[model samples]
Target: MILFKKKPWKLVTITSTLIFIIFVVLVMASIIIQISNYKFDKSQAKRNEYIISTSLLNSGLSFEVAKGDINGIESIINDYLSYKEIHAIEVRKLTREVIYRKQKTINKELRIVAKTYSLLSQYDEISIDGLDKVENKEVKTIAKVVITFSSNYMNKKITQQALFTGGLLFIAVMITIFFLYLFNRYIYKYLNNIINTMNSIKQGDNITLKNKGIYRVEELNAIYRSLQELSETIYKRDAQLKDSLNQAMEAKILAQEAEQFKEDFIRAISHDIKTPVGVIINLISMIVEQSDTIKDNPSLSEKVNACYESSIVLKEIMTELFNFEEFEQQKLIENKTKVNLNEIFSQIKSLYETKFSEKGLGFSVYKGSQQTTQLLYYINIDKGKLLLVLENLLDNALKFTESGAISITWIVKKDSLLIQIKDSGIGIPEDKYKVIFNKHIQLNNISTSTHQGRGLGLFYVKRIIDLLGAEITLSSKVDIGSVFKINIPITSTMSTNTENTLLLTEELSKSNFKALIIDDDQHTCFTLTEMLNKYGIETASENIPEIGLSQMTKESFDLAFIDFHMPNLSGDVIMKKLTSTLPKNTTFYVCITAESSPYHLEKLDTLFHEVLEKPFDITDLQAVLQKALKSKRVTNEVINNIKGKS
Candidate 1:
């Protein structure tokens, strides 16, 4: 009852009230009809007295005889047998209300009448005074009837009516219950669907109400539709919020990338500047301080050597920074040239020989056997950019190798040259090997007191190798050692070595040679002309390409130097045009570049007698001039020999 079963209670209440009310009406109708029929039978028996009295008179039977005459009544009853129930009759004399004389008899059928009421006095022939008459007493005569009849038909009629009414009520109750059951099923089904849908929503599932037209209950379907609308609204709101969150996350990521870019830029600028300043300071200190032990005022040549060495180191760092950005952006174009492995490796060894010896660490370089790798021939490459890559590797090795040996070895594999830089140092962990080439990835534990790398060296190596369509790999174990390997595809070769250049400082000051210097920078041209004059070479210079070309064609010069970069027409185009027009001229062509062109140096060597990088030492300039003079001498000798043979 506490649960308040509303539907079931309503079904029972309504059906029971109606069926019972109908039951009461039907039962009361049967009872009233039965009672009325009994009364009618009683009145019908009472009315039969009049008929009997008249029948007795017609039959010549006296009233006096009916009181005591059984045979006479029998004769009368036989004559008037129409009164089937005239079993007996009594005529009684009463004084006011007292009975005086009373008689009773049986009919011819021997049926006796039994009266129901008691008389106050009975018939007494012997009274209080022995049959004496009483004065002032009035006497009257009355008859009584004793009637009995069968009520089988009346009872049977009432019984049939009750049965019929009860049957109708029973049918009505059953039909009500059946319809109620059907209604209950509909209500249960609708509620069950709603409950299941609510559960799904509560469980965080997306839901939609469907097939509602099939349900018969309009209100329930309306509620269901409203629920469906509500669910859709919630889902739409949730989706919008989720999208907003994702956009926020993307914005955060972009901001982080910008910050990282800024940091990388600052780090690059500082790292590039630091190494060169240290080298310059150290070089100057060595020249000034150590010269006192050499018994000489530091010669111009010594100071120049110091400046050139510092410049070479500074140029290398800057080039690495440029290549780093270029490679990362995939903007570094390929400039393939024949690279003499022997010459480049010899230069690297010489460059690091003093440092290694000072550190008391051994450095060795090896070339693979002829059967293993073709190391003796010139391989194609971008010498200048690749030079930075090797420099980075060597610097890393130098920073890590304190005591044990460092080795640079190369073997020609099928389709590629595999170069390995191995070092015995505080090695990297094996797990960190994969990420070691990622920029900013570094190890704290190493050979040096302070590790000087910004962790971008290997990253630059990886990118450069990838640009060259090659691969790089690393292997290491903590406290053991590490080996970094680079696989470079072999490039096609085109040319051989050029004239040998040697430093001729004293010769440069004593001799006079006419030279033409063409450069885009006016200051650069001025500096070159002044320096060449100091070296006893007569020089004419021009920053404009047209003027320089005119001077070159007009005058038969012994030597000409041109800067590769200019405002509009590049030095390469100017040189090709000038040399083509003056094919037979004895003037030597030289390319003066601000950066190393090791990448294309071999091809450039075939084009120009010599290549000079900017911020040149006096010695390098003398070497270029000496090479030019030597080639002229050799050419004159070959010409004379050819003329004699002819």
Candidate 2:
């Protein structure tokens, strides 16, 4: 098939030539058989009719002569001239010496013949005793009759049939020849030329074949038509290939530009993360050093805590980017489980209730019928992803609605569960509803407030929903309200277990721990250090891992966060150094690379005891840390719990 597309004319020529030869042979054979059969049938039928008529006439003559009805015979013979039934007539007289025969005194006579025979059985005795045995011993007379009749109807039919058949055969042969010639000329010749042209084209010759006239044979005509169609198809396919190649080249250029942009942006943002964090850490250190001076002022501690919270939020945002990137690229292992919606919703409501009150936005959930509320309250879902989806939606509602109430209603249809989040606020335009879930295409009206998000929240919500294969609908009226209907299936049991591993990890974070940070980016190190400090852990850095072996020798750290990329040494290389230098029992290794390429992750998996992707979230970091820490403890229950939760 591909070859045909590549060189259609060549295939057409070969196929059409074979078909033409077969058609010519079939047509000639049919014509010859029909003509020969027609001639044979006509001649045989005429001869049989003539013999039958002669036999019937001879029988009539013998019947009359045996009766010795001479007058009757004479009358019958005379009557034959005027008898329209007699096709032909002849009369004969027999005597001792000779016999006489004539065809009814007609000037133009048809061919007729007669003969007589004597009875030689009566010998000379019978001839002498003729007076006694046979008084009138006359010589026995016999007659042979032959007559020819012009079968005007039969002959005419035969002649007409022969002429018609011959004419038809000749016409058919001529037509077949003409068509065959046409097929070879217009179709096969042109197709072969086009095939050669196509072959040349494939070999980098771009000459186009000119169009030829129609074919003389139908089969060849079809081939020619297909060739034309094929030519067009090839032209179109070539154009498409060229376009695709150009697009691929353009995408390559764009990717390079994007990579450069990301590099520059990360450098600049790294400074942003480190500068404030460094200042706050220094201030905290100074405050702790001069604790006696501000012992009475309690607001200072509060101020310190506020600064700490801001820094943590910043770090969290960055870490979330890392987690989301992994999730988007399908790198993160999804710890899915059947989530009780009612229980989770209750927790979210309690957590956000104070905030909703502070903002004076009415937030309520109406407990409808058991069937309706059951769908919304109980669903088997990925609790973490579901939380994110709800958080994004509620955040949008609260951000947009100032005075109006926000209500969440549940509708249980026959096939699906629908949870509608209605907010009385500046509604989204109908046109924007479809694009609102898209990254960076937030609703126009909602963008008026200072609560402008990173534009990834809704995108994340949509991603999570899609991962679960759920349906969502958004309806709104401008300045009135907006309703988002999320329909999740009731039978979505991603996993059979219901244990919350996140809470377990939160409990494990109470212990004091030591961690090693190996990253080229200073911001990543500082940000992660701050977040980890909140969980009572200390972080040390080894930028570029220049003295990785030296550092591990000096400090016996509990965990190592190694970035995959460095100036010369890679994260896996640093890990190898740590494993060789550190104690034989040390298995605290995590790879945190921002390369985002698939190869990096595959390589990371083979080297690290545990892999933590960059832009680490405190929750994820704590979880990975706990898992790594628990590896040393080797608790079967914890392992089972983690497996069950997952």
Candidate 3:
């Protein structure tokens, strides 16, 4: 029944149909033979009856009738009628008078008769004693014998035989058909299972032949075994592939972690080196700043200036190394804020002015025209990136320019700000303009004398300008000069209000502003203390953080300088402690560190009121002092306001 619901297989359907048709044909032929035998039996029965009557006439019944012996004829008829097939018998005279008659009460409708006439003439046997000769002559009819036989029984027997044979044939045909159906269904089941298993394998299913010996056919069983082997192979291969993939993933994770550790180590070492380098540069600059004492000794002054310049160069080399690492690591993230272009330009000018002077080159920064200056040069920008760009360009200009001037000129327009750094240096060839900005490219024709460059300054500048979404262009003529112009798109602008500059006066110096310095390095503390003492400000220094925190608790210093990296406690932890314990806005906390990475600076910015990068010269010191004094003044004014309101 379940097999019937499925679509029939073409081979099975066609073969079964042919077998059924053949069976039907055979059954029909058998029926035809039975029917023919029945007809033949009926005809044979009639012929046999005729032969029996003729035999009785020849066996003296005819003579008996000729002699008028009716009893003898009756006896012969009676003897024949004893047969079941014979129903009646009779003898009649030549004049048609019944001589002897015997009949049984049989169904007349089913009876058939055979009649024979007996001759009255006798045969003559002639004489030559040993040889008898019979003479044949035509004899007239004297008596007739008729025999009736019932055909009903013969017909019934023939019919029963035919029915029995046909019944057996029919049963044989049905059994043949049933077995054929079962054979077809068995083959169909195995073939269907094979097809389903193949399809499962094609779909990437993990198929197994559960009943391996179920397929009786040798070929089908062979195919099943092969499929089982293939499935097992695929399962093993997949497992191996999965294990390899997992191992590869683990190795990749370890590689990334190692790379991270490498970068961290490099950053840490670079920062550590920068602090001491900064101190040396600053201390040398301070010594050089005392021009009066050194002016008398030309040789000593020359040596001192040379040392300062060499230290400055060393510092620059370290800076370039750090910048290279940063670029390689792609650590520059854009952090835009409102910045005054004027102040940024002023700082760059101040930073490079002395260096340009020492190299006998005129340096100046022009903040556009008077009208442009009054209109505020404030705009939204990434200040650190812009500083890097301007500083790198200026450094390049200073390196190449021997005698003439280097100037930075900027002007604020309606939608954009245009900055141009012009230098009277050996100009670049027009063909080399684009390639000059490529990494590790330098002009071999131009002599850079004692100023060695790593050829990455312009590359850094171009990358930073691209990051800022600003466009930079270069125009140059050979040996005439080169001018780099930067056009920055400004989305918004703001104006700055004028504020009274904090003047360092004798009265302010005498104002007993005690400062606290917390640092693990005694050299840094001593330098800072000396600088503050010169300003008439009393200062105390602590080499340990715990001692520093205790000192802060005992005294309420107006200003504090904290070193960022200490052994016992880090600068941020100290700041956090101070913020939690100390009064709000009491001490103006300044964070001093050599770490210039953006992440560390950003974190320090949140904790400290001001972050002062290490190797501070007199100017950086003065700036911190001025900002601290301004903050203290604001705090005092706020307190006075609160008292007045109360």
Candidate 4:
């Protein structure tokens, strides 16, 4: 077999070729031997004929012929003819006279003739008869003999020898070929098996060769044993790796579960802490709002204001703590609502105007051109997150600035809002701009300032900006001022008059607008009732959701404030039951919650018409009332339109 034609150095091919050449040589040698033997046999037969003729002359056969003794010649010839090879013999004198002749019948075509000549002479005796003696004897030709030999015997002998040699050579060659075939098959079988095993290994099969018998060749057997050992080692290693991987996966699941438990614990603690904190802050805020009563006592007002400020700060710290954990976990929920930039701007102005004046710093807000103001800047955005980002930036500015002016400028472009907060304070280095946005990173030069913080303000701002898909860049020089420019992409916009036309007058108080407050916390119910009563809206408070539901069924209220978490029934469950039976578009349901968890808040957002986070002041309450009033007006308008059509 031609295993590899390109590489002729293979052992089997070389050996087979050599054997074939040897076989051809042996065949040629046999033919040469046959030819040489045939010639040798023919030559031997000619030599025998010559010897016979010469012996006759030596025995004086030629003299016998001269004496006319034909019988003697005939007897000698007859003796020679007794041999089978000599077919015929003839004797004649020198003058061509036949002395004696003998022949045997043989195949004429199978006979070969040979000729022999003999000379005869007589020597004179010295003195026995006293005759003349001659020193030199006279030589004379007496007779010649011709013999015919049969070639058939020589031909048969040569053929038999040739046939014998050829038969032996053929047998030897066949035996050699058979042996070579066995050797080739044996080598190929093991070699192919080794190659197949290697290929299987390459294909990721752990094939064990232990069951296969050892090879006769020591080298091949050793390699096979090594392969078996390697396969076993690989299998063991794979099992170990799989076990390790399974353990690692189990550990990872445990770690995730622990992390979830930690998050839940933090959320539960925040809820418990924030509920009372919200109540305290709101109650203090109401006390602080009673300015007429406290204005006469400066000492009392100052202490109350200090307490109010401290509580506000504590609330802010708690909020930041919760926000940090939520942002770290990437679990901050985004709730987008239609908001007015003017209102947000007004809030910011109200919050920071007094603080900046106390610091002996100039504060100014530029709201762009008159045309920009005329177009209602109503945009869909997460209002709380945006406020957080702005507050962080402004707080950072207020903290860093000593006595310089701080200015805020905002403008509306085609489909985006751009705001810039510029502060004439200690500026940041160019290299530190990007680094300052990382959590817990601060400028080293400014680390000793009295207003130094945990370095979370800008980081929080960056996280909120990124969450809102907005862009903020800072430009600053040392000892100069810094300007932070922010560009927020607006997904949607509206151009309309967003002014609140609802006026709170005696007519509105007599309008018979009623609101329901359902909360498991009596303090929250009382707070909400007091806030609603200020708007001249009649309020009924229920601590139990079941009682609230029963009250709701008996009387229809224009507005209902429901707490998210309750003992018997949750806010969502109550809302679901009431929404089915209550008149649609008549009652506005608001969910009040102290829980800061995004999961719970997201669920409540889906179930409630409005979600009011706790710790809100009169401004927040006023906003909710305005919305309820707007909704009631729309419902009344729709009803009147239907009645008129009918």
Which candidate's lDDT is highest? 4
Model 4, position 343, has a per-residue lDDT of 76
Q: List the residue pairs that clash in candidate 3.
A: none
lDDT (tens digit, per residue) of candidate 2 on 99-119 = 223344453544333222222
Error of 3 at 238 (Å): 3.8
The CA-based lDDT of model 2 is what? Answer: 0.60
> Which has the higher lDDT value, candidate number 1 or candidate number 4?
4
If scored against the real structure, what TM-score would every candidate get? 0.43, 0.48, 0.60, 0.68
Q: Give candidate 4 misplaced runs (Cα > 4 Å).
A: 1-212, 332-334, 338-342, 353-362, 369-380, 413-415, 447-452, 490-511, 580-585, 595-602
Off by over 4 Å in 2: 1-114, 117-332, 335-391, 404-456, 465-544, 553-565, 580-583, 590-606, 610-646
The lDDT of model 4 is 0.77
* lDDT of each residue in 528-596, candidate 4, tens digit only: 777777678889999988989989989888889988778879889998898787746478889988776
Residue-level lDDT for 520 in candidate 3: 91
Q: How far off is residue 455 in model 3, in Å?
A: 4.9
Tens digits of per-residue lDDT for model 1, 231-256: 77777877787799899899889978
* True lDDT of residue 126, candidate 3: 40
Q: What is the C-alpha lDDT of each candidate?
A: 0.63, 0.60, 0.76, 0.77
What C-alpha lDDT, on a 0 to 100 scale, does residue 410 get in candidate 3?
83
How are the candidates ranked when ordered by lDDT, highest leading? 4, 3, 1, 2
Query: Candidate 1: minimum summed lDDT over ten consecutive residues — where?
Result: 117-126
Candidate structures ordered by TM-score, highest first:
4, 3, 2, 1
